[model samples]
Target chain A: MVPSEAKKYLSKEQFIHQAFSYLEKGVEPTVKTLWLNDEIQEKITEILEHSYPKLRLRYWQHDDQTVWFLDEIGKERPISFGISVKSQRINLVKVLEFRESRGGEIHMQAFTEQFDQIKLTDDNKLNKHIDGITGATMSVSAMKKIARVALMLDKEVR
Target chain B: MKFKLALVSAALLACGTVNAAEPTNQELLDLIKSQQKEIENLKKSVEEADEKAEASVEAAEKTMSNAADSKLSFGGYGELHYNNIEDKESIDFHRFVTFMGYEFNEDIRFFSELEVEHSLSGDGKPGEVELEQAYVEIDVTDATSIKSGLFLVPVGILNETHEPPTFYGVERNPVEKNIIPSTWWEAGAGVTTELAAGITADFAIHSGLEVPNDGGVYDFNIRSGRQKVAKANADSFAYTARIKYTAIPGLELAASIQHQTDLTQGVLNADANLYTAHAIYNVDGFGIRALYAGWDVDSEQAELAGQDKQDGFFVEPSYRFNDEFGVFARYSEWDNVAGNSIDTEMEQTNVGFNYWPHQNVVFKFDLERRDGAQDGDGFNLGVGYQF
Candidate 1:
């Protein structure tokens, strides 16, 4: 890849780098794409309180191990974010694109880094605590939903 | 399994013919090395193809999202109200509003709100259709924007975001309506910017109020001074400035000031200024809101009419049991004729509840008590929604 091309959208590139950085040397990662079935779609809708239009998701895996689950969510508009899971625990969370006028603060590393090492509880909720940003409640809620969905999908695909 | 068996049989035969026709150890090692090299080449090709496929999907998703983002967006809010007072009972569909917005590009866009009030409009009906806001906004930078055309003045909290389902109460708080003069808009151009983290500032220059000097029923009702950009008189201009701080979670504090050079449009020697301050605290399911607003009119004519120095304040606290149920209480006091030698204070208290069937729909009920010269009690019911 060209170095100059990577600078075009820095946030997106940064997320990609972080996702792949967890891999061992010479381990080739491949993409795994899935379509939203009725059950998955219903759970997502319940969490978001709104139905999403697109029906497909793409994740990355290395040597049969799920590495990252990437998706976009909407508060007022779509926010591109990703989650990385290792041994059933979240290793990293990153916000790739933030389009809303408010809640851009959710993209800050200080906020997203808190999701690291979190696991799903018995009730399928996030086990670790997350702090919310002021005036960005909707955006923060969307991020939490994304994290839950990612954890669930990791279990299913494995 | 079949390949492994074949290799074992060949190796046994070679061992049996050690001195006869048999492969050398160096040749066997060379063959194994060649096979490993081929496998590595195949893996490299596969990885490259996978990388290309991922990049293609990413590009496609980006293109689709960009197209969707550029599409025209539509939403709106409306409300119906029923008022039962000591002297009369009335039911009215107070407002039907529609919002339309279009993005010309990433940096420029148009937004508008069209509203119909009182549910009807005719030769003898008491209703009208109006444009509450229509503005073209240009992003000057990531943190600043400039807007021009008819827009709500940045003097009050509800003026910009008063969708029915968002606020708490059956009817709007009287303090905002009577003193700050909400639902207020005018022809104007303005700039809004983030002054710091969680702090915002706005300034606007707009067509000023044009209070008629005919000494009629609306002579002292400051709420009636709004021209609403309808062939508005522009003999003199108005300037408004506001600052809001929300750096703390669950707390917002704001202040606004507005000055009109000629409240009477040069018809009477009158100039007016308004000051307003408010705070809203919302945490968990508990909330509190308080506001104080006052107006000062500098004119001999206004003073004679007892219309100078009008002021009011209100405090409201509410609790939500859950997403769908909440209750609140409020106390308000005001006097539009405060300059009069005889006291004209009007004090009121209200208790209310809101039932939300959905996040976008609400049913509201409230009971109110009014004391002073126009002492009375009333009940209000309202249903409202946004989409």
Candidate 2:
């Protein structure tokens, strides 16, 4: 996780953090899951090159805003992303941890900022076009999929 | 409740008791008991559903934890094709590859691709088992990365990301094949860094080509000179550098230059330089791509053999009907003996359609017309997938 990065926004009262989350210096979070249905399962499969392994997605929520820590395989390693959806749109998208030696540029704010106010269409496509990083097409694609899945699920639990 | 009352009514009828106007209290009591039983069953069902939901969350968390232990990830792509050239037809499993990588940490990782081409590898079989890429990359900073070991030379577009479904046509375009000699990799170290907004650069020094110096029509076949890093000669090395600009949302422009100290690795006193320029623009469903690549060799023998200068260019325009279907057409012209100036160059026109049943799986069909050198027309059919 991007400790300084996620902390900067987390302390802005975006969502109330319980005592347990702060007990271990932000080491543990109050995790919850959004169980999948046939529709969401099909969409996840479409977004991922392989089958979406997890039948249920773990997330954190307070009121209408939910934060999703999702991971997808970029090339050959899992790139973890932290996304917060409010009002059925992405308000924050951060590359929490990037394991691949390449495409680490996706973690930069210049790229992740494109997801701001991004919405999912009725047919489950991103409403806004996200520009790709040069030489980092797969990583850019993975981030987009994670954002779509986050918004689609936000429609569920929210 | 209605069905329960009906069952009660039927039971009474079966017991030889039929009442028209009013039901006895005993009948009323039985109806109440059945209604209560149905309500309890529904309540139990809801409780079971909640339990199942909890169980699902537990299973998912368990899967996540299990995934954490395995730092390695795997994926692959394969292509199988059938070609009909001049009414002569043949089929082949063109390529099959299993690629994988391991992440040692956040900033360092290892990636590799093991490829099998033409289905088999032996002394006489028309196939090869090649390690296309096996490299360890370390991030020196947020904007720079260095990779060493056998890696794909970042010379052309397809050389790096040539997964079948990613591009159109049953076969790769011939310009990139004959001129750029894509699917090419060498043992080397390279660094990629961001130079400015939307501008990136790459520089690498790697094992150089060894085009056979023996005199023949194919004396300077750039495509055949790849050592594939198998006991390669190190008498000379190649240096390559490229700069790319992708700041515009749907446009990418790049140029690359490469220099080889000795094309024959000291066998012949020949030096080579390659110049490449490419552009890609994609917006909505319409797209266009163009590439120009050329080589200049400095050797008296090569000049005498008419193999000193070689070059090619191709332009492809495509329209993606949607996420799953697209159409493309390409015009290409290339030569391996431009030094002769006899206009001995091969030109081709190809039109193709790609159907992506899934984003990573594609069915491709194409027709090609060749107008120079090799005079033949052919149709190709292929299916490819990556996971």
Leading candidate by lDDT: 2
After superposition, the stretches of candidate 1 with alpha carbons farther than 4 Å from their true spots are: A1-35, A49-55, A59-76, A82-96, A102-158, B1-67
TM-score (0 to 1) of chain B for each candidate: 0.86, 0.84
Task: Rate residue A18 of model 1 by lDDT.
Answer: 68
Give the per-residue lDDT digits (tens) of candidate 2, residues B170-247: 999898899889999999899988786578899999999999878765687898888899999989999999998776
Q: What residue pairs are clashing in model 2?
A: none
Which structure among the candidates has the greatest DockQ?
A: 1
Instruction: State the lDDT of candidate 2 residue by residue for A4-51, as single tens digits.
Output: 001122232333242123335545444686766777778777766445
lDDT of each: 0.78, 0.81
Alpha-carbon DockQ of candidate 1: 0.14
Tell me the lDDT of candidate 2.
Answer: 0.81
For candidate 1 chain A, which ten residues in a row score worst on lDDT? Answer: A1-10
Worst-scoring 10-residue span by lDDT in model 1 chain B: B62-71
